[model samples]
Target: MESQVTNNANALRLFFTDDVFVVEDKSVQIVLPAVTEAVSATVSIPKVEAKEAVVVVENTVIPAEKPLPPSESYAQKGEILPIVEEPLQPKAFKFLGGNKKSVLILVNDAAYDVSTEQGRELLRKIVKAVDLATPDFALLNYANYKGTTYAELHQFFKPQIMLSFGVEASHLQLNLNWAGEIIVHETTRIIFAPNLHPLDSDLSAKKSLWGNLQKIK
Candidate 1:
């Protein structure tokens, strides 16, 4: 109803101008909305065709990053690069007897300081098993010999036979010419033996070492 009243008010505004006086005899003139002439011109739109497309992505191979090897520049003139010899491998346990000789026993570890009574006792058992006129026993803990090469070991100890105990059995084989368990590298004979942790208790380990020791000696 309000919308109809508003529409009628707007219609009356078109009939009576703002200049007309509020009187019963007042005149009203009707004014119609003017329409402009229609504008006509040419508009051209281009046609586009939709089509399918194939996209192929080739796999690129990326090479692994490698560490660069250490490089040294050449010597200029008189100066010389001091020759690098096998580093001195310290004895974990000192030589039982002074000189490096015939039978070098490579022990896995020691019960105590190898110089002690317990160490000597451990040695006495193995030394007794071998049959030799003098025996001239020498002992080295394998832990001491890790850094030393077999070649340097051969040169230093210069043993006729190398008896390795525990994990050192396979370790002593490094840098040495060998067939299997038994290794005959020039003069030195290497015999790999089972671990002797509970040395005195395990009779079989002692017997195994003693048995193989007999073959080489």
Candidate 2:
């Protein structure tokens, strides 16, 4: 019986051979041997847990477009034309030889030519005659002949009634006629004649001749 007890003690020493042993309460205890050096040991472990998954959602908005006007479309077509008007003609007057009663004499003595001197003198005489015969006559010298300087002699004169000799009647006729109370003379007529008819009466329908001769006188 003592031998069996020794055998049991040896078996227990083998089973608890390590320096530490685990107990039923999950705690550990270290054992030291009496006749040998003590041994040590350390143990490590990890814990794990279960989890669930998740999802997410969202929403958004957009804007609408607008239409253009009809007039803007027509403007882009490019087919319309603009209207224009004709210019009116200037009124004509007797610029040279006419009735002494309504005559306007313009003497151009500015000409350097010697031949024009006699013409200038003759113009002076005609101007004097017109002034004496009709108080309504207008006499302008070379200094006063403004507007068209290089225009035709008649255009330069612009007379209501022109009493002239030689080139004067010819120049007057170039731009005007006997229509507007004109009495042209190639040669000086000693006897003067007056038109009994009123000056506003349409003597010629060729040109647009209107306006009262009373205004001119």
Could you say which candidate leads in TM-score? Answer: 1
Best by lDDT: 1
The TM-scores, one per candidate, come to 0.45, 0.24
* Per-candidate clash tally: 0, 5
Task: Give the 10-residue window scoring lowest on summed lDDT in candidate 2.
Answer: 190-199
Which sections of candidate 1 miss by over 4 Å? 1-93, 99-101, 115-122, 132-135, 167-170, 173-181, 199-204
Q: How much is the lDDT of residue 133 in candidate 2?
A: 41
Flag regions of model 2 displaced more than 4 Å: 1-103, 106-115, 132-159, 162-217
| Alpha carbon lDDT of each predicted model | 0.62, 0.37
List, residue by residue over 1-217, the lDDT tens digit for candidate 2: 4464445776889778878765586455656666765555555555555445555555555555565554554435676755565543343433324334544444433343211544445434434533444344544433233342213333433444543222233333333344434334432121111211221232442122222222223
Model 1 earns a TM-score of 0.45
Question: Where does the lowest 10-residue lDDT sum fall in candidate 1?
Answer: 110-119
In terms of TM-score, how similar is model 2 to the real structure? 0.24
* Whole-structure CA lDDT of model 2: 0.37
